[model samples]
Target: MITPIYRVQCDGPGKEWLSLPEGHVTGADVTADNLIAAPTAKRACNWPGEKEAKRAAVGAGWRHAPDSDFKTWFCPACQSAGTRP
Candidate 1:
């Protein structure tokens, strides 16, 4: 199955950056090489303390149709908007 990946920061006692896919943990003492597959619902907490994350998930590209709560679409132009600025 395809899953969203996350870049994690490890600080405090140690420092490192890790790539934690749906099944990985990126945190202290764990380098990229130390990654392991986490449980299926690993990303449950990814949005808890993050504002940008919640924004990206809900505000990125979505629409409300007649029968749907909201539909989502990707804006390629928006991705490039940062370079122009």
Candidate 2:
């Protein structure tokens, strides 16, 4: 069975942090179309489970924004730069 992959999005301007690839499509092969369609952003904490992902994210200077409707994770650069909303 395929499990969900969790990735923490970084609200930073750093190219390194903003260029991380998002999770792969489940139950699908990596094709050219998919590769081109895959969305990428400033993200980290690529893990299989949410809890571990969040833990690692936090450990890596990511913070969970409680006010956002969706789960938003800000990277260290964003935090340091005051770019987080």
Candidate 3:
């Protein structure tokens, strides 16, 4: 499981600058420190609003970035295009 608070490599990449590998999140990562097995140094998307958005993205087989300038989560296809200027 992985959560993004800033730019990161997600999926194939185009600067998705995003995770949770399905079973991993529900398995080994279930009780691994925080809810998502993300890097402790990195700020996770723990904010309420961002959390909701992230949930949606995960359900859609994509990743979420609350810091995105567009203010919307992206599916893999859109994630490649939603770059920060």
Candidate 4:
């Protein structure tokens, strides 16, 4: 079976500055690892093709940080205010 490998673009802060929301709860002991482990799916794209996915994400005002992992993406509002997750 050819399981399609769709690229998941997370609508959250880039890994470099990734962190949980101010009041987010994980039901576990708060730790550095977990604090930055959560990712929000507020806006996501599951396009099978990398180029197409990136095109769609960018079209929606998502910016890909060059220094971050490919999966990390910031929403339009965040990008405008230069905010981080």
Candidate 5:
């Protein structure tokens, strides 16, 4: 299993805590599409997670790809890319 990246934060009572414990890795994949009429027109451009992920990616400097194959969750910039790795 992959070890999750840790996000440290100061607790309400001034204690440091690991917001993300571990083993929270994300995964993504794309599907095959074909359209002889137009190449660009067949592309999947509408990324559903764009709004929220972009904000987080801007603050974090870098972002990971979508967390699932279904476009359910993703970091900001990754969502902007709108392509699975």
Candidate 6:
């Protein structure tokens, strides 16, 4: 099993607690956008992940946003289009 990442913090004199842990996603948990469109398109896209996403992001005219680890791995197009990752 994967170890969860988290940190503890003191809110006030009342008590202290831990913050919500942001879970990590393995490659298996990731899905390609092409796969999402496959059912409708009736074909497999076989689109790559990080590399392709970064490329698409650059192509979309962004300097450096897709590379941010602060958020999930959203598609470059989605990020450019202002959608949630």
Off by over 4 Å in 4: 5-8, 11-44, 69-71
lDDT of 4: 0.49
Give lDDT: candidate 3, residue 59: 51
TM-score, every prediction: 0.20, 0.55, 0.23, 0.45, 0.19, 0.22
Candidate whose TM-score is highest: 2
Cα RMSD to the true fold for all candidates: 14.1, 9.1, 11.9, 10.8, 18.3, 15.1
Summing lDDT over every window of 10 consecutive residues in candidate 1, give the lowest-scoring window: 10-19
Q: Arrange candidates by TM-score, highest first: which order?
A: 2, 4, 3, 6, 1, 5
- In order, the Cα lDDT scores of the candidates are 0.31, 0.52, 0.41, 0.49, 0.29, 0.31
lDDT of 2 by residue, 1-85 (tens): 9778775556456523312335654554433222211135433324678776566666555665679644776766667777777
Q: Model 1, which residues run further than 4 Å from truth?
A: 1-39, 49-51, 58-85
List, residue by residue over 18-76, the lDDT tens digit for candidate 3.
33333443334322223332333243333235555455446545554656653544445
Task: Flag the better candidate by TM-score, 5 or 6.
Answer: 6
Which sections of candidate 3 miss by over 4 Å? 1-54, 66-71, 81-85
For candidate 6, the TM-score is 0.22
Question: Considering TM-score, which of the candidate structures 1 and 3 is the better prediction for this target?
Answer: 3
Candidate 6: where are CA atoms >4 Å away? 1-47, 65-85
In Å, residue 50's CA in model 4 sits off its true spot by 1.8
> For model 3, how many clashes?
2
Candidate 6, residues 1-85, lDDT tens digits: the string is 7543332212123222221113423344333221221112222222345555444333333333345552233333344455532
lDDT of 5 at 51: 52
- Which one is best on lDDT? 2
lDDT, model 1, position 35: 38
Error of 3 at 59 (Å): 2.6
Residue-by-residue lDDT tens digits, candidate 4, 1-85: 7756344444544432233345555454433333232244432223567776566556555677776765667755566667644
